[model samples]
Target chain A: MKNLNRRDFLKTAALGAAAATLGTKSAKASEKLLSEDRLGVLVDTSVCVGCRHCEWACRLAHNMPSPALDYYSNPTVLKEFRRPDKTALTVVNEFENDKNPNLPIHVKIQCMHCDHPACVSACIVGALTKNEDGSVVWDDGKCIGCRYCMVACQFQIPTYDYDVSIDPHIRKCDFCTERRKEGQLPACVNICPNEALVFGKRSEILRIAKNRTKRKPDIYINHIYGESEIGGTSWVYIAGKDFNELKMPPLGKNPAPGISEAIQHGIFAYFVPPVTLYALLGTIMWVTKRRNESADKDKHDHHSDSHDHHSDSGRDPYRTSGHNTYRDSGHNTYRDSGLSTDKDTKGDNL
Target chain B: MKPAPVKHRFFTPGVIILAVLALNGLIFLAVRFISGLGAVTNLDNNTPWGLWIGVDVAAGVALAAGGFTSAALGHVIHREHYHAIVRPALLTALLGYTFVAFAVCVDIGRFYYIWHPLIMWNGNSALFEVGICVMIYMTVLYIEFLPIVTEKFMGKVNLPGFLETFNEPADKLLRMLNSGLSKTMFIFIIAGVVLSTLHQSSLGTLMVIAGQKMHPLWQTPVLPLLFLLSAIAVGFPMIIFESLIASRSFKMKPEMKILSRLGSMVAPILGVYLAVKIGDMFISDDFKYILKFDVPAWMFMAETGLIIIAFVLFLSKETTRSPGRLFLASSLVIAGVLLNRINNFIVAYKPLYDPVAYFPSFGEISVTVGCIALLVLIYRAVVIYFPVISHK
Candidate 1:
C-alpha cells in the first residue's frame, strides 16, 4: 500500500511539473510586449494611384496563384469591393474619393499585425505568435485547425485552405518574413510605383505619418487608422477621407483581448473561483445530507409507531404506493391493472 | 436498489429511421475526413464554426448537465429519491460527451492533432480550459459509470468458448473494480461536477474573445455566468424530459410524484437564469439592440421568450401535476437553451469584413442530425442491455 501511494504521488508530481512548464510557455507568449525596433509600414492612401501593382507583387511573392502582372493593371476590377482571401494574401480595393471624387483612392488590405493580436491570444495551441519583427506568423506545424484565430481576428485577415484535404494551412500575409530575412523590403512596398508605402521602424514610421498628416492637413485625414486602434497595428494608414468611408472598422483604443482576458482571468485566477465553487457545493451537499438523515430518522420513527397498522395492511404504504406504482407492477399485476381505481385512491391517500 | 433492463423489442420503425440517419451521417463523415471540411461543410474562414460546434458540441454539453445535476442530487445532496434517475442520466452524459468529442474530431481540420491540447497547455486560452475540462470530465463520467458496468457483469461473466477460461478471473476483477469504485466514487462525482461547471461556462468564455464579432445581444462580460446558470437551470429539466420520454416509450408508469417535485425545482432555477439574463442585458445597456429587428435581435427574443414561457408553465400546479404538461415544459427549457447556444455561437456571430451569410450545408446538417440519432440509438441500446433505466 505504501509503495502504491508513493508511486501515485511520483506520477502526479511529474504530471503537475509538465503541466506547469506548458502553462508558463503559453503565458510567456502573452507577456512578451511589442519590440521597440519592430518594423511597420506607413500607407499614404492619398498618394496611392490605384495602380494595383502591389496586388500582383504580393501574389508573386507569396507564390500564390496569380494572373500575369498586366492582368492586375485592369482598373475595371476595382468596381466591386474585394477582401484578401485564401487565393490572395493581399488585395487592393478602390474607394470613390469623397474629397476628390474624380480620382479613386486605393487601399491595400492585408494583415494589420496588431501589437496584441486577437488571433494569437485566441489560439488554444499557441500556433499563432507575435514575433519581435512585428510580424504575426502562424506555425503550420503547431496548428490544430480549430479556426478560433479566424473567428478572433478583428480584421478577419487569416484565411484557411478549407479546400485542401490534407495538411491545409491558414493563409495570411506574413509581412514578408522570409524577404525580411534577406534584408529586402516587402513585395508590395518594393513594387509600389509612387513610394506610397513607407517601411521603417514602427516609431520612425509613426513620426513620418504624423508629420505628413500635419503638413498636408488639407489633403489628409486628421487620423492615423492603425495608431492606437486596438492597441496599434504595424500597418498604419493615412487616407484623404474618413477611415470609415474607406471601409475600415471603427475600433476603440483599448486592445481587443483586454476585456476578454480580464474576465476570463478574473474568474479563473489561480483556479480560486472554481475551488470556491466546489467548496460551496460541498457545503450544500453536507447540509442537505444532514437534513436528509434527520428527516429519514423521523420517518423511521413514524414507521415504527405505525408498524402494526402497516403490517395489517400487508405492505408498507409509504414504500409501495404513489410513485412506486411501477415497482409494484412487477409483482402485483392484479392490484396494478384490475384494481386500478382502488389503487389510485389508495396512492392519493399515501 | 439496482436498475434493471427494460424489456423492449429492438426493431421499431423509429429505431430503423435512426439507424438510417446514423448510416447516412457516417457516409458524410467519410467524405469530410477524406475530402476535407470544405466538401461536406459550408464553413469558410469567416464562419469556422457551424452547426457542428453550435448544436453538437454546445447544445450537447448543455443537455448533458443532467448527469452532474442528478449525481449531485442523489449522492452528494443525499436525495435518495433521485437515485432512480441518476444511472440513466450518467449513461446519457457518458454517451453525450463521447459523441461531443467525436463531433469535435470531425469538426477540426486537423483531426489527428486533437490530443495536442492535452500536452500543449495554454491556460490563458478559454478554449484550452474548456478542452481540458471536457476531457477530464468525460473520463470522470465514465469512471462514475463503471459500477453499473460491473453490476451488470458481476456474476454473469460466463463465456461460451475459449474465453470461458478467463470468466472466473474476469468476475474477480469485476468484483474488485466494483468495490474499489464504490469506495472512491464520491471523488469522481465531485470532480465531474466541478469539471462540468468549468467547461459549461468556458464554452461561453470561448466566444467572449470574439468580442465585437458577437452581437451585443448575446455578448457580455457576465456571459460565462449566464451560460453556467442556464446549464444548471436546464439540468433537472433534461433529466425530466428523458425520464418522461423513456417511461412512455417503455410502457412504464411515469413517476409522477418524483417528477413533479423535480418539475417544481425548475421554476426557481429558471427564475434565477431569466433574472440574470435580463439583468445582464439591461446592465450592459444592450437592451436597445433588441429593437433593431435584425436576425440576432429576433433570435434573442425567441430564446428568452421560450425560457420565460417554460418558467411560467413550470410554476403552475396543473403543469407540474400532469406528466404530459411537465414534459412539454421541460422540452421548452431544453429548446430554449439549445437556441441560446446556437444563437450565441453561430447566429449572433458576424465577422467584421465578410458580408456573406453562412448556413450549414446539407452534409453538415445531416452529420449533426446523425449524431443526435446515434445518441438516441445508443441510449436505447444501453437501456435495453445494461441496467440504465429503472425497472422498479
Candidate 2:
C-alpha cells in the first residue's frame, strides 16, 4: 500500500510540474521586444499652438464622447493642467512657454508606448500587450479590471471607469494600432495643424529629433525626452523647457519591472528554492520527531533502571551482585549529575 | 487533553454591536453594487485602488500569517507543545483568505471575471504570483480544517430530512476521509507554509513596479524580504491576540505558559525584521527622506515606531507573563503591520498629476469595518460550534 501511495504521489507531482511549466509563459517583455522598423512619435511642443484638436480627434477615434470641433478651441479649459482619464484617452495640457510668453506650449500627453512597458509586464492576466509595432494596447476581453496596470504605469496614462461597475474598460492610448494597420497616421498626429507631431520609424524620428534640436539649439532642449528614459519609450518629445517642467515623471534608465521580475524569477527559479526549502523543512521535522521519541525512551529507561535497583535492594540484594561494576559506573554518573547526594548514597549501597 | 467546542450563548452586547456594524456595512455594500464603486469609494481615475485593496486585502493577508507560522512551528518543526494553538490560527487564516478573495471580487470592476487569473497567465506579474498562491493556500487551509469538522460530526451527523437515510453513509464517508487525511496530512501542512511564504512576500512585490511614483521610504528592492520577515514576526502575536480574546469571551483561563513562550520568540524575529528594515533604509540612504518629515515620512515613522515599541514590549518578561501587557504588545505589532501595508499601498503612491490626495470615503470605511466585525462574529460562531480551542 505504501509503495503504491509513493508511486501515485510521484505521478501526481510530475503532472503538476508539467502543468505549471505549460501554464504561464512570461509576458512579451520577457525578451528584448524592440522589433526593427518599429514606429515612434516625436512631439515638438515649441511648435504647438494649443489648439486641443488632438484631444477631440483622440476621443472621436476611440468611440468616446467628443464635442464639436469648435468646442476644443476653448482655451478656458487649458488654464488648469489635465491628464488622460476615462473620459479621454489623450489630452493636451497647456504649459506656459517662458521662451515665448505670448504662445503657450500645448503638450499632448498619452501612453508613451514604451519599448519596455511596465503595464504589459505588470498586468496580472496578460491583458495588456506590447505589439511589435511599438504600441501598448489593452485587450478588453482579457482585462479583469484589477487596475494594477494603472499603478504600474510610470506615465500614469491608463485610466478606468469607476462609475461603471461592470465591464469597465482600462482606458489608455493604443497609439492608433487600427489606423496604422490601415496605412493612416494616429488621429492626433493626423489632425495636428502644425506638423509638430511627426510619426515614423523609431530610429528615424529619434535622429530627426536630435537634428531638429541641433539645428535650432535655442528653440528646443538638448535632451530628447523618452529617447532613453525607462529604457527608451516609443513616444519621444522635444520641448524648450525641461521634461520635468513638462510634467513627465522622472524615471531611471532601467526598466520599471526589472528588480521585481528578477526577484520573482529568483524565488521560483526552476522551482528549486521552494522545493529545497520544503525538503529541508521536512528533514528537520523528521529528525526532530525521532530525537524527541528517543529522548522520551531514554528517560523511560532511566526510570526503569532506578525501579530495578530499588527492587534489588528491597527484595533480593545479593541476586544481582554480578552487576556491581555497572552499578559503580552508575555511581560515577550519579556523582557527576549532582542531582542529589541521596542518589549517590543509593548508588554506593548498590 | 483533546480540544472541544466552547459552550456559550450566542448573543452578547458586543456581538449585538458587531451585528449592527455588519448591517450598516451591508447597506453601503448594496449601494456600491447598485450605483458603482464611485458612489462608495474615494477612488477615481488617478487612484484605482484604495481602502479595499489596502486594508481589506493586503493587511488581511499579512495578519493571516499566524496560520503558516504556527503550522511551521507545531507540525513542521514537530513542537508538540504548540499543537494547542495551531487549530485557532488555522481557522483565522482560512477565514482571512476567504475574505481577501471576496474583497478582490468586490473591488475589481469586472466582478464576474475574478476567475480570469486562474486561466490567464502572466509569469512576470507579482500580483499573479500572489493570486495563485493565495488561492492554493486557501484550499490547503480548508483541507487542514477538515479534521475539525470530522471530529465534530463523525458519529453525530443527524440529517433532518429524507436524507437522514444517508447519515450512516455520511459518517462512514467522513471516517474514510479522516483516515485518508491523517495518512497524507503532511503534504498539505508543508504546502500551506510554502504557499504562505510565497504569497506574503509577493504582496510586497506588488508595489515594486510602481517605481518612482512610490515613496522611497516604503519602496525598495528588498521590500519582499521585509514583508516576509514582518509577516513571520507578527504570526505569533496575532495568535496570541486572538487567543486571548477567545479565552476572554469563552470565560476560560488564557494559556499563559505556551503563550509566554511564543511571545519570547517574537522579539528575536522582530529584531531581525527591524534590523533589515533600518539597514535597507541606510543602505539606500533613504533615511534622509524620513528627515524631510512629510506625510509619507510621518507615516513611515509611525509604522517603524510602533514596531520598535512592540519589539521592546515583547522583550520584557513582565509583558509576556501578564495577559493585558501581552495583548497591548500584540496590538501594537498588529497595528504597526497594518499601518505598514497602508503606507505602502495608499500613502506612498504619489502620481505626477494627482489633483488631490486619496482618502477612503465614509462608505468605504463603513464596509471595511463591517467586514472585519463580521469576520470576528463568524470566528466566534466557529469556535463555539467546533473543537478548536484546547483546554489544559
Candidate of highest TM-score = 2
At residue A24, what lDDT does model 2 achieve? 24
Question: Across residues A1-350, which tens digit of lDDT does each residue of candidate 2 receive?
Answer: 12113432232232244322322233233445578888999998888888988888898888888889998888899998888887888888888889878988888889999988889889999999988888989998889999999999989889988787667889989999888789889999999999889999999999999999999998887999998788789999998988898788777676676566666766676687789888888888778757655644544465444332211111122323323433556755643554431221121000
Name the top lDDT candidate.
2
Docking class of 1: acceptable
CAPRI grade, predicted model 2: acceptable
lDDT, candidate 2, equals 0.83
Candidate 1 lDDT over A25-57, as tens digits, reads 433445476678998999999888888889888
lDDT of 1 by residue, B295-335 (tens): 88899999999999999999999999999899999999999
Ten contiguous residues minimizing lDDT sum, candidate 1 chain B: B74-83
lDDT of predicted model 1: 0.81
CA lDDT of each candidate? Answer: 0.81, 0.83
lDDT of 2 by residue, B217-283 (tens): 8887678888999999989999999999989988999989779989999999999999989977766
